[model samples]
Target: MAKSPMDTLQLSYIQIAIAFLLFAQAKSTTEHTSTPQPNDTNTACIASERSALLAFRAGLSDPANLLSSWKGDDCCGWKGVYCSNRTGHVVKLDLQGSGYTIDSDSRKVLAGNISSSLLGLQHLRYLDLSFNEFDKMQIPEFIGSLHKLRYLDLSMSMFIGRIPPQLGNLSNLQYLDLRSSYQDRDIHDGTYSTDIMWLSRLTSLEHLDMTYVDLSAIVHWLPVVNMLPTLKFLFLTSCQLRTSPESLQLSNLTSLETLFLVGNQFHQRSTPNWFWDLTSLKYLDISYNGFYGPFPDEIGNMTSMVELHLSANSLVGMMPSNMKNLCNLEVLYSYTSNINGSITELLHR
Candidate 1:
């Protein structure tokens, strides 16, 4: 049927409009398909993290059904597993309460020897192996290989022998807790250097807890720890430091927040002038020492201080008047001291 010119033009215009709409729809679909989906990538990474943990368990000969419940496709369902919601990478592994027993044949517990298998977890940041027995196990040198590790809690684990100097290789390590209630008291001579020069390598270390570690000669090297710029928390309880450093210079650690020297022999007379320079310190505890002196007047500079403990010392002086500036001060313990201060002032402030 031959149509008129007007009919033919109208038909051509309708076909052109339909073709344009179809082209637009196709372009939109292509863009939507090409765009990368971050959620899918994260899901895949999370699945990989879970598989790595499972592989780690499988590599160990667990005769005692220790990690039996760790089976499943969902990583979040497993115990002691924490995944970052944003990146879907495993961030924390708190396996402290898991019932992992020692193998009767090897006399070794699961996850005792830090192996390359565990080290394969590149995204892992926090690892808690406390309350587990890793007795006489030489810390895997590869543990220092974890570049992303930030917090490590090995406390209450029967880790014997001198600390591995290779641990200084963990540049990102911030918190290190190595306290053990039943730790070996026999200090292996020549096993570890009292100088601890290796500690200087951990530039990012902030909190260091070496409670009950044999530190007879380590007191002399305490000043060297001042080289760490980010160091804020220091715990040396029962370290056997006979006297505080004569210089007591830690001025570089401007970020220092907590200073604990409990159960040391740092007498009051040995306290140096630099002790007052810890302007950023918020918590200071030097109890169970033979310290005897007036609390430094510069205590007022620690305006951010919240807790202060100077108990079991021979401190003899009236509390400083500028102490009122410590608006955040909450807990102050000066018991067993010659400190003569009106309690009313502190209570009112």
Candidate 2:
């Protein structure tokens, strides 16, 4: 049958409408399948990791109810626990306390055993239990088994006895802080490390702080510390370090920015120190030591120094003329009696 022009136009319109409907239907089907649906894998954490965390919490005495939220199967939802979004694996456990303060009540901090059950967390990378009470127990040797650990902080905790050498097994560790508080300094009951040879294994270390930890017995401590090429911030205040023999004349701390060696036993010595080679130093504090005699002219070499502390020492003699080269210097702290000559010449530089 021969159709008229009007009939043809109407047929074409019908065909276009049918094609549009078909396209819409196919698009809706793809959107339904391709869209992300609720999966139990993403919402629920790994079963084995959850059990490990529960066991870890069992050994702790949470006086402040810090672990009160540590209930239910989803351990990821618990306090101070973080899980990987993709794998649902536990990666970090941070239970840092407010530290033992004179004004705060004893019930405010966590006190008890750090369970060995933490070994079950194979993927764990970061662990921090600083500022808590551990009943003066030694650090567990089993902690060395966690090979994935990158950050470990036990500072200001009431741990006693020698620092476990097993901590050296953490080759990936970047930050290690074990600053402790002593119950009795006379008896040396606080954490002490006589043999720190294991420290050389931590090649990736960047920041190390061992304030208040007795390292006087370790005569070769300086050389072992120099092994860390990436170390930037080092704090060894009140560690009873000695300043004799001058084992290392030049430090390998190319990236070292801040150094604190206050309250050490560098007694009655005018010898040249090794740290003067660190021209990159921004902050240096060597106060409260037994250093005596003339201040070394080497101080002028550290032009990058911003703050220099030489207080509480027996240093004497005039300021070095080269000290005027410290253009970037901002703060200079020293005992006035330590300076003998006129400061007008150095100040004008």
Per-residue alpha-carbon lDDT of candidate 1 for residues 257-315, written as tens digits (9 for 90 to 100): 77777777766462454556788888777777787878667777789898777766787
Badly placed stretches (over 4 Å) of model 1 are 1-42, 45-55, 58-66, 72-77, 82-92, 98-112, 183-185, 188-193, 246-250, 268-270
Q: 227-283, model 2: which lDDT tens digit per residue?
A: 998887777888888854443666678888778887788785655767777888987
Worst 10 residues of 2 by lDDT: 30-39
Instruction: Give me the overall lDDT of model 1.
Output: 0.65
Candidate 2 global lDDT: 0.77
TM-score of each: 0.71, 0.83
For model 2, the stretches where C-alpha displacement exceeds 4 angstroms are 1-43, 244-250, 341-349
Clashes of 1: 2
